[model samples]
Target chain A: MTSSSRIQRRAFLGRAGGVVAGGAAMGARLAVPVATAEESAGPAATRKSVAIIPPVAAVAQPVREALAASYQIRMLDPFVRFDQSLEEWAAGRRAMGDSLRGCDAIVYAPEPAPDRDEASLDELTRGTYDLLNVAASQKVQLVVFLSTLELMADYPKEFEVDEGFMPTTDTSVRRMSLYLAEFACREFAREGKLRCITLRIGQLANASATPASAGPLSVSPGEVARAVKAAVDVGFSQPSRLANWEIFHIQSSHSQARSSTEKAILQLGWKPDQD
Target chain B: MKVLILGANGYMGPHVVRKLAPAHQLRITDIRPAPEEIVNEFPKQEFMDVDVTSVEQVRSAARGMDAIINLSVVRQDPILAFHVNTLGCLHVMRTAVEFGIRRVINTGPHFAVAGPSYEQMDYRISPDIPPHPGIGLYPLSKSLGQEICRTYANQHDIQVLELLFYSLRDRHELEPGTGGVPFLIEWEDAAEAFRLALEVDSKELPSRCEVFFVFGDIPQMKFSNKKAKELLGFKPRQDVSAPWKRG
Candidate 1:
């Protein structure tokens, strides 16, 4: 089979085989068939937990602060954004593992470096996989990633310049970033250890945005916090392809200047407090 | 009372066991093979292997139990979302009815009330939306599952407690977002919600069939927890700003 076919098959089977039975025993795996029912039901309580792993940087501080309000979260990256030593980074990851040892869910924020150089993307990608592996070891329940919606729009030509593959030209760069984020989420959802979520956030209307527009298409840090809280509070149905690795456009209701992201707000029950 | 826990081995199962073990006789069933450690912990709880889809197995498994807390779902199949969530729910409810059991606390997502759009802001969603749009099968399935619960409540005289659960968390994996809106109900709060649903009077619930948001009192809660509080008397004790305790 071709590599693409293999990947498709893997995705199919991963979804099919991961049917979790809730009670005395979960759905039987073909391999395990049926273990003693006594062995099935108790681990769920003691075994499951979620962890958040954010990339350390000036930009991510707000995001980190937002996650803390609603989740049992821990930040793994050092405060130093660009100046950390190799030892510091390693210690940070090791420390992350220690923090995540007993958890079953992981909300990951893998920040893209200012320069999307091959080395930076490659390192971030590899590091992402490494985090996935760590979650797998701990049987983490879900993996949520903060992906960029603007990455596609703000630098569409640049992204094409950087990476030879561009999937579609139909949508705007921002919408395309949402799709790309989904692609990455699909790629990383392996071993059932990682259930990726790419928050295709629109232009963040923090205090940092240049010359303010009169339109209502802006989102604030406070709004982002409320959105993330909704994502966390809304318990998930079984982690399936339904919403798994899905890319959501993150914006407020008033930001309906374009279309509205009322769909996400409705799904997770998120109501952002406006400035 | 003899109680049967579906998904008895899940994140909230052990906690359920902890809560229910004090007074009732508990039996747990799941698809996962029983873990040795849990066996050692609750030696008295009988574990059984039965798929909720199989009506015969459900009937047989539910025969002597007073209540059934279903927590099973199709993990991978988007198409099976409805079948597992709705049909499985129907089967469990029907089984409960057959066995003369009245109370059933089934696990459901808060998204059943809201949809993908609701994820952006924390707001109250009425249980009256015309089912979730078929965005994906999971929400559809969950919406259908809620329908089944309503059917059982109306037709079979079974009291169904649908906990519209969201962001249930442990200490490590939880992420309380920064915005002032509260979301993510801590696991302890979830436990309390279920416990109250299990213990509270049927009249005390919202309408004959009720949908309660099983979330902590995060400042920016997507679904309103007021009904849950009013009916079930569950007050979330966790702080909304503790994790991101901002100035």
Candidate 2:
């Protein structure tokens, strides 16, 4: 069998095995008829439904494949665009919410369009915050907010960045955004109402990336999808009690930023077979 | 091996103590009497009162210990930064030579050898990078600390390894709405890194003084553990957020 096939098979079996193990541990009372994937004794083929919220419809095709293969994901196309008209956006937000209300989980990858942030960065930030609430009020089991890596450009001098150390305080705008999302999620998680996982994605290698932005430090749509699957089914690193907010930066195996990427490969079990 | 750690009361001090306790006969020396409360905390170890900057105090603490790990520094007093980092380090190195200690592991920030600007670049600040202190007493003092290792390696034949780490967010979560990930090392991972550093053979201490970054294997952490993985064989398994898991 091809290496990629082997990996996919292994991933499937591992996930399937985990569910079966969980069910078996729960005893006969919890046993259910779970059909394993044919042609391979792997995890059940049944996929979990996921709702995706993006800023615009510039949906990367590879990302679509990864999510569809692993999850029963519902894509809210023509991604949300915020303009001067609040009323117009509200109608759109409600439509987006109505479509997503039935999914088991929500995934947000909001990329502010050129016009969306013309009003101001604050408006864009607030608009996304409102979208998150749409998911929280519905009590989705999991909400994964995609994010970016903690690049040096992201922070001012006050917060230091080292591969092996954490700066005592971070004053970066990028860092601040992540903290805000986690903070919002914490209030909801407090009542055991919802679970939130913030993914600090690396630079993605899609048509969206320019010559100046391509490299090892970036992530791909496919990689992000696999990561989302890993996070949703394989499970996430727990939420912080300091507020149940968790953050993860997703990057592919070929990150151009040498040491940090190498460290990720060795430490976390993340490796990208595709470029 | 028996190890002595100075600054046992500081932020990373107790962690060094806990990490080394399992394999080495650990002797911790702080400026003040390690509080009864804190001493009672790590039951299997011993504590001593020693002002690390003093030659005599450090010399006394050096007796019977095979190596020393220094973490104490002058916080507000920038002038004193040189004294503790340079002179104080001189005292520890001299004492180690006199006592026939085989190895010494020093704590330095990753920036000790690189500038804040270099952080954005795609490179690892290996020990080979010339020590470059940008601004701030902390980085400068740490640079001097790196120099101390160089001096000891050249003159006294004492082997020293400097460990640099960042993204260690065990103390507080990044405030909400920030892309700031919990790039943190739990108290456990911090301890383990030091433990591995303390155990490495003096001969294994790479010539020209080496720097290794240490921290937990969080997906979003900035500090990379690549070198530590190769040299110390240290792998951190604990996820700071894992303990918060629930159905």
Candidate 3:
């Protein structure tokens, strides 16, 4: 972190640049046209660059496609293997810092294997912090952290949650890790140099799968992609609110009464395209 | 003024003792008994053995002090680290409030904010950077200690000044660097920072809980001490290498 007085305009540009032309057009009925470099020259850079960490997860495919269609995309593999030593972790952080340069935004989705041991989970936690430090160093405008909504798995059958709901009593490792990630992001975001958006996603269905008839809450990969787009768009359009730090619950509209997507809709101007 | 120094046997404690002994009535306590040399030298000052981890001992040691400076820490033992670093801080703060000690100085390493993993070594760090997760046990516990300070300062009628120190070394020592980390401060400069922190008027400080980075003037500095300079009148009298230039 630089002196507060010397924090560069790139920090402001990263957060407020998108709002110059697109502020008034954002809301429930947003129509974002694919902007070209020439069209977005003044304050709005048409070709913004996004770096996605651990880029190959199945849930990220739609997000990658959506971002690629609109912005230049950089895929970063933050090598956070379970077996790496502290030295290797530092080396990886240095490498990630190199990749973060010139990027306007970053999407971090570290998909640890389900059967990963405690050591692997610890590494994943460190990796996430390393990524944040690199992004903060580069002063990336927006960071979309993809976290699981499984933290709320113990909620009663019809319980609905919003961004304001607290998970004080939960002690599960998955839940605690997500909470820690959010806390770490808040540390950077509170400084106003960077904007952090946490999307606590529900169970991810196949990109092409239809809505389940009934059972558990799940969202298709494409819907997840749309949620990511909405988060980025909101970050750009509403610099005052979303540009600081905001978390939203994301699920397909079809998921019956298990989780609430109201905050996502009202806050980020996002609604699942599929019912 | 009466000042209580916790963890008075650490590396930087003697320097602080030397600086403050001339003006203030000092009471120095640590888990280890105060050395006979310090006791003989500062005959007017009081020295005792008190474990900061014990709330009763810390409270008893803090009874008559106008202010408290907590320097006690455990770096290696994971369980003792939290007990002494985090919970001990809680004890200190609670004792301060009970004793009507309005001004408190909490000492921690730069790792409390910049993290020990060397992840943010490339960037210039100020007190504002959030504590990176997985900074291992020592720094994590110290960071938690800071949070405790913040909580007490906000909820109670006490003012807390947290001074985050970087490499405490002598002027002639080769700059400390294991893997590209560039921040360092001389022992004298760090002790001076503590003295200045103690001397700064409450009116000059902006909030009840404030943090400042204390390090020497190194070129292309990795950690900025501007806040310390501006608010606490900190002036580094030592020069260290610019890590970026060395490589």
Candidate 4:
């Protein structure tokens, strides 16, 4: 058996645009032209409704307050608690849909919590999809997902870690749960369901609490808020051909920072004015 | 070696059990209890009702087992799809680590790796390609589950082999052409890969995690079965390509 017969290269493109666009949404959502809101354009055309999803209500306050300063920040009250029974989840799904309607963008920060067990983490990962489904159905313009810098924590303190650097292999239910949530969001973006930007923020502590884990890369809590706002307004960076899925690593400036924050500053036009 | 089959109530699980029963002791589990025939056949054997979504139950199932084969999955129902197919893998891997189990055989459909995207380009398709599960629930959920198993295998001392099948046919009937699933595998041929995966030496695998596209040879050979053949020494006893031949 000659190698030529065993492997023959055919002369066909096999149809361009092979079926990846209309993911899980099935058929219709692809045809419905999604609404696009200008990135914080002119004089207050009724401030674009930007919803903040902080997993538990306690995950992000500074980020919420910062976003609230500029846009209409809608906090999903009670949150989508999937730990509840199936009956509750049925109602919760509907409630989550109700919460996301008419939003221009969403900032999903499913950060870790000390009290969250493995089951709750699983719930949070799935709940993220439910939230994005509603957001996509409503034709929400953009989603700024707040992932963590800790996921890629294996590199040296002096290493120049970019957004493209593969994350750590940590399979703890907590870390893997967050990574899986990001994976789902990427498919939605790749399918053009909605414009999504994942901001992997560095370790941060609010006004007077000790940092969660000691690290050379201590980000100011306020920088995280600014990154979220800038991500919402980054539409100005590219008007005609904005990428469907983009990732930016934002961290405070340090003499010995672990990961580089150059992309966030250049693309989102972010600032590093330490509070 | 003792084997534990999680989600063993499905159509394929019984065939796998039938093949392994004589040589290996088995424990089977699923959301529903085993079928009556299996209960009667494997009388006095332990059959636990396990919901793969529950970590507690998954952990309990892995205890005292040498190897685990996960056949559980949910194709539709958006909510339950991710919970059962995606998180189910996480629960199983977590249990494997807790119980110090060394090997796991995870199963999913070929579409999980070769979705509508890959289907469009039809030649020499293999499981080595990056998974573009598209947006379908079954593919997306199972692909994510594979990712979890891959991560677990890379991080820990467990060896994970993922078997991706397209369609399984009856040997006697020998249906040809890509009717339902584009690729076809004889039922016995598909079930036999599990035994090869279980018995293969850990040193033979190129990495901690390996994915195999399990199917028999076809005339067009749109999908390649070479990887499974070379790695696990899988041979399709049934002549799958014969029906495609013209007299």
Top candidate on DockQ is 4
In what order do the candidates fall by TM-score, top score first?
4, 3, 1, 2
Error of 2 at A202 (Å): 53
- Full-model lDDT, candidate 1: 0.54
By summed lDDT, which 10 consecutive residues of candidate 2 chain B come out lowest?
A: B174-183
- After superposition, which runs of candidate 4 have C-alpha atoms over 4 Å from their true positions? A1-46, A55-59, A77-79, A208-214, A236-241, B121-123, B176-178, B219-222, B241-247
Model 3 alpha-carbon miss at residue B24, Å: 0.9
Candidate 3 on A150-263: residue-level lDDT in tens? 656666765555566654213233444454456556656755558889888776654344433322456656667888888877776743555477888876554253566777
* Range of the 10 consecutive residues with the lowest summed lDDT in candidate 3 chain B: B173-182
Task: List all candidate RMSDs to the true structure.
Answer: 21.9, 22.0, 15.2, 11.4
- Which of 1 and 4 is the better model by lDDT? 4
Candidate 2 falls in which docking quality class? incorrect
Candidate 3 is graded, for docking, as incorrect
- What lDDT score goes with residue B108 in model 2? 63
Here, model 4's chain A TM-score works out at 0.75
lDDT of 2 at B223: 45
Per-residue CA lDDT of model 4 for A134-185, tens digit only, reads 7888888898887777778887755668888986647765567667778878
lDDT of 2: 0.54
Task: Give fnat, all candidates.
Answer: 0.00, 0.00, 0.00, 0.58
The interface root mean square deviation of candidate 4 comes to: 1.7
Question: In candidate 2, which residue ranges exceed 4 Å CA deviation?
Answer: A1-275, B42-44, B120-127, B171-183, B202-205, B218-223, B240-247
C-alpha displacement of B165 in model 2, angstroms? Answer: 2.5
TM-score head-to-head 1 vs 3, winner: 3
TM-score of chain A of each: 0.58, 0.58, 0.75, 0.75
